[model samples]
Target: MTSRAAGASLPGLTGTPLDPDQEEARRLLQEELDSGDYRVEESWLVRLWRWFTDLLPDPASFGPLPGWSTWAILGVVGAAVVAGVLFVTRDRWRAARLSPTGPAGAVLDGMRRSAADYRSAAREAMDAGRLDDAVLEAYRAIAAGAIERTLLEDRPGRTAHEVALELGPTFVDSADALRRAGDVFDAVRYGDHRASTDQARAVLELEARLAQARPELGADRHPGLVVPS
Candidate 1:
């Protein structure tokens, strides 16, 4: 619609009555929106949707979000960046909690040692047909290792999701081992669930490999471990 044609009669975004500039903006926005799907063309609406989707609020910012002022928008972006950093810095958080070194290498060291002890305990328990103890031991081992290696200083800890993030791809193999063991451990611990001998064996093997591999890599933190520490 022409700017003049799409007058006060046009619907405002919130369905409120249109003011002159609003109507004009809406008309312009509408025109941009109506420019057809950005499919092959990437319409302005699609771009706006993408932009807005990217503009999430900070967790610390709480609620009562405002209109897109430069500062508010910047806040949203800053929040997103902070969230990303926190996510990626999870290993550092855990390590700091444990060793005060915030060193990924040290954390991994702890994880490996912990994993070995847990695996041994779990194997013994599983062999004796004590599923409950095996499961419990598995988790305890991981937690202890995480504390010693990842969060030693912060006994009785928090989420490792944040900590695993800071670890580089090299650390991923060990992390994967921890995650797999964790899953099986959960199934056994959280319920009266039964795992087959094969499943239990798999979990043990993964944990063992992770434990061994971690120490071999040495305590040198990956450059990607992100040190300001």
Candidate 2:
């Protein structure tokens, strides 16, 4: 009966029944082939999606973000970046506007003009209503006159404030004015300050007073000069 059943089951079978273990193995193998798991291949996009999903938590655990929120966050970040860049550019531009030679004294750097020359330039600038130029020229005159009278050393890089400090004891009455003039020079030269007509006149007046004033006998010596004992 078993042989007859085997022959009837398949035409190639030689009327021989398969053993119980062999039959069970064949059934399991057929089930695996019919499932199509081994024969199917995943596309690159699907594989990439799986990899990305593996890094994230379950979608059910978190609510989806509103579509507008993403753009809002990006816009805020972009604006912050733009503001930071503008701030840096402004600082660098300010630095570029300043003299490259040195401090406030740089206004007179490399110029061999006499104090009288600076005074002439100041007068011309004031007449033309170029108050900024007038202020600068007046400050230069002060610096040049100090060097000529040995009140200040004829040195490069000596700032306006340093010159004022050195001449303060000699010109005791105008000490405060000297300091203020130095501040004004720095503001007009390096800062974004605009010199008014009154400011220009004040600087010119200070320069004139400094020219007429006499330094103390002891203060006449330049820092670079040495007197033999």
Model 1 Cα displacement at 117 (Å)?
5.4
Which stretches in model 1 have alpha-carbon errors above 4 Å?
1-119, 150-153, 159-170, 215-229
Give the count of colliding residue pairs in each prediction. 13, 0
Instruction: Let me know the TM-score candidate 2 reaches against the reference structure.
Output: 0.50
Q: Rate the local accuracy (lDDT) of all candidates.
A: 0.52, 0.74
Q: Write the per-residue lDDT of candidate 1 for residues 1-229, one digit (tens) a residue.
A: 5664544355434433345576677776777577674427678656755776666556456665555665876787668766866898898864333331221112222344554577578889888987666655654555555444542234333323333333224356566655544545444544344666765666556544534444323345432222212
Query: TM-score winner among the candidates?
Result: 2
Per-model TM-score, in order, reads 0.36, 0.50
Top model number, lDDT: 2
lDDT of 2 by residue, 75-188 (tens): 865676567668869967654544233345464677579999999999999999999889889988998988887777778887777877887987898999888777777778
